[model samples]
Target chain A: MAGENALNFQMIEAAAGRLAGHVRETPLLNSPFIDAIAGRRVWVKAECLQHTGSFKFRGGWSAVSALEGAGGVLAYSSGNHAQGVAAAARAHGREAVIVMPEDAPAVKIANTRAYGAEVVLYDRATGDREAIGAELAEARGLTLIRPYDEPLVIAGQGTCGLEIARQAAEAGVTGGDVIVCCGGGGLTSGIALALERTAPGFRVRPAEPEGFDDVARSLASGMIQKNNALGGSICDAIVTPQPGELTFPIMQRLCGPGVAVSDEEALRAVAQAFLRLKIVVEPGGAVALASALFQGDAIEGEDVVVVVSGGNVDAGVFAEAIRTYGDAA
Target chain B: MAGENALNFQMIEAAAGRLAGHVRETPLLNSPFIDAIAGRRVWVKAECLQHTGSFKFRGGWSAVSALEGAGGVLAYSSGNHAQGVAAAARAHGREAVIVMPEDAPAVKIANTRAYGAEVVLYDRATGDREAIGAELAEARGLTLIRPYDEPLVIAGQGTCGLEIARQAAEAGVTGGDVIVCCGGGGLTSGIALALERTAPGFRVRPAEPEGFDDVARSLASGMIQKNNALGGSICDAIVTPQPGELTFPIMQRLCGPGVAVSDEEALRAVAQAFLRLKIVVEPGGAVALASALFQGDAIEGEDVVVVVSGGNVDAGVFAEAIRTYGDAA
Candidate 1:
């Protein structure tokens, strides 16, 4: 366990060094409105503005860079992570093969292609992308860069937490609760390590979307738990059914209590961020803010840091989401 | 002429002092994609993220501050400027009375009210807002804050240009063509002064909406001009019939050749800014970018600055605009 912890921290540091300047140091915005509503001073870490519009770039780039001279990389994702891997591969001047579900938004597929990635489509219900991805990797001799399960990828994802800690320190928010939207515990695990290393007293919290509360249940059970019926949350980016093996232990050890919020709350938070801050945040990116607003009592009077994780929603989807839940004003 | 020039400059300086910290120093983003299309280095001064979501805030705040201790302020605007005055008045702890056309989008009216202003509605065809505003001001002893005609307001608007110049200087854009979306020339005049003072070699240009090219014709004729029909452009914020008396002379002295772009181009520019930079820009705010993309050959090889002046579009309008012209993504 001690050796594993040391390795995790070392990997995160290495990932940070490797991915520097390739991704944006997304703004950490001070929100008076959210603070008023939550009864806490809230600072939002806007990773939605990250390159390729998600925090996945950190892990994607980290994973690809670790392969060093690996000829090509492969990934299976329906959303932001796919774009992240594609963009990261392009940045490193390597070919990327992405296996996306057929029902993926046309914009996402086009964006992946625009980044010079070859996209292979499969039916969402009938196909196993992991199996297909594995086959393709073996055939092409390309390294498979899993979206979240790998240690290198988790370490890369932790750079966001490192950034949050750094930004929070600058804003005098040391030792506060840092809430991140969690899907497979990849981002949560990474953030946990960052908080533990940089700000030891700070509490790292994972916010899971309602109906897909695997992380929350896993933390309570002291072991990873699967949600068999994982309905689509508005936070599609973080709607994984189970936690990653490597990420789960780190999250269990370092993270604090988990919070859950409804899809409506997430949509409202996205609208608020867009209208008030003039930012375009996807539903998934607004999960942290949703947690702050809906689960305010959990973070009462504690200076809170909510990570806005990505902004890659299609225009049509965004319009529908806003119409469904946005405040009239 | 010299006295008028001195007055304009002084008002701008005073407005800058008065409105400091109340407004954002919105980012001036360098657009690689736009530059590639235009064959020029295109930099966008994103004022769309300004307080109240438009450059109108500068003028609104400046005008209200000039009224010093006035109990209430009154203004007539269709949207962005109305919200600007309302919000600015609230910021200064004064009551605001906005005379808006009833035909204005519900969102704009709600936004103005959200800023704590009293909204007085009048019919666009049957009721004259100017007459209504004057009567209200006279009855209540309220100060009348004109949208753009006043020297103080122009000076306040000029601060946006001042910021653009300061930001451009910091970014090492020493000399270039600075393009502003033109309405009544308030923003253009203000920016021209800022460029002349800070970046002497920079040429300031104004971009007018197609079919509403009064500023372009005015520059050519050395006098203010008006268009008979003015509803063709998506740049609603800059569809003014003629340049203000105080603003036209400044624009004439400092502005270069004017350009115009279609409504489709303006709408597309707004979508591009949102996708690329994650900034919400209104149609008028995107005029300069539209001009750059559509009229690329005009500024070939030159470093160009396009001022994205506002971002207060209604959700309905934004949805329609994107559906019609946001095919670029």
Candidate 2:
């Protein structure tokens, strides 16, 4: 579990070069309104506007590209990652097979299919998508693209942090802290590695939903912990029971103190982003903003960067979230 | 009246240079999904993400910058224009006095003041904002910045269409048809002039909310038509009763065809934009999209551009709009 040979500046630089024409260099938006509220400077990396509506595309594209000469790819994801894999595979003229839970949102399923992937649905109660994906990969000799555990994937996600660092420098802001919403530690670990190489003086922090605090617990205990009984949360995108083995160690070594916020806080943050920044962010994407807003005192008086991880919520869910939290404010 | 020599491409070019460093060159997004729905190639000019959440800032900044060396400026508006004027004036290091209706949203008032403008509220039923603005201008010898009627303001607004043309060209798509949501004809007229100069083959069309179809009526009559009974619509931004005298002739001469859409259509378009594009566009901004979606046959098989004019809605109003149209498929 020692952070030996983990992601570093070199890997991130290579990832950027590989992803130059493949993925979008999403805008890093400075929020004067949010800054006034938090009494500190806040810049938001809007990955919500990325292709396939999330940063998952970065990792998927990077992994598929790295395995260029390999067969097609197989992945197991219920949402954004599914679309990402599908898109990345199509972009490289390779076939992608996504194992998704049958109960996944129709919009997500449609998006996955739209990216030209064949989706295999399994019952969430009794089926194991990983086993199905493994079988498929073995049968077809396709590479199993792990969502976060792979070095290539982590390097790809690091490009987001690289862009943030570059944009911040271009905007004349020297250095500060970078905050990212953690699900399986993919984005957070990648950002940490990217900042370490690009903006060495900057600190990287991970923000997680309150109920699914596996990363926080893992960091505290120095071991990955499973929270199978925690059930679903509004930030469903980050509801992983345990972090990937490859990502956990890097995250532990490079990420700053992890912070957790309530489902209500995340929902409010989504609504706040829509109201203040006129950007629609999914619940998981809003976790970083939630941490910055409700926990302002924790990282006060320093320039802060919040990673808006995605924007792919169902209209019904978005409306419900807005009604519940938008009205409360 | 024939089109006057008052507004010209040279003036708009100058305005573009003057406002270059001040305003954001908002994105012009191409959507294959929207194209499939509308049966044409559709590009959306996302002014919803513009500074102060509207295209008004372009003209506001141009007008204020033109007179910053003179003295203070006064404007009369109850909505987005007021905020834009205040922000632009403040950015130019001048004082702004805004005459707003008493019933204007508190958010608009707060936003105007946040930019350091003095907000003077008057009862819409009895008070004349124009008289108040004139008096303030006379007493202080300050320049009166009209919301849409002035030549400089029109030139400034033209910059949006200029950017649209440039973006379209950069994306390898050239002239076709451009649809702009019209209020008092400022944006449509300005955009028409810009497109005529830059993309000469491109046709400009103004889309108006049904009851306030003054632009359409004015174009048909060859004169500005006043409709005092224009009903309240969800598109509060472009619900003006009449086309501006200065804006009408230019619009009639240069704009190809005018279209009208229902408030429900506008609301649905807003929901679609939020869900599909992750951008919050106000009802007026959505009008162009609505026209495209509902009246696709009007401009069939053409490379169409829809201007998403603004994004400044109160949470309550936005929630209501979402609830009403978000599930419309």
Worst 10 residues of 2 chain B by lDDT: B27-36
Tens digits of lDDT, candidate 2, B165-204: 8878876678777889998888888999998988887888
TM-score of each: 0.84, 0.93
**Chain A TM-score, cand. 2:** 0.94
**lDDT of all predictions:** 0.80, 0.83
| Top-TM-score structure, candidate number | 2
Highest DockQ, which number?
2
DockQ of each: 0.34, 0.47
Residue A141, candidate 2: C-alpha displacement in angstroms: 3.6
lDDT by residue for model 1 over B131-249, one digit each (tens)?
A: 89889989998888877777777778889877877777776788878889989888888889867776787888899888888988999999788887756666777898788887788
Clashes of each: 1, 0
lDDT of 2 by residue, A1-329 (tens): 21438557787788788788668777667546677776788888888878778999899988888775758999899888888889989988999999999998887887788789999999999998878888898899888887888788888998998888888887667677778999888899898888887788778888888868888888888888877654678888888879888888888888777789998888888887876677789998999988888888778447888999999877766777766665322
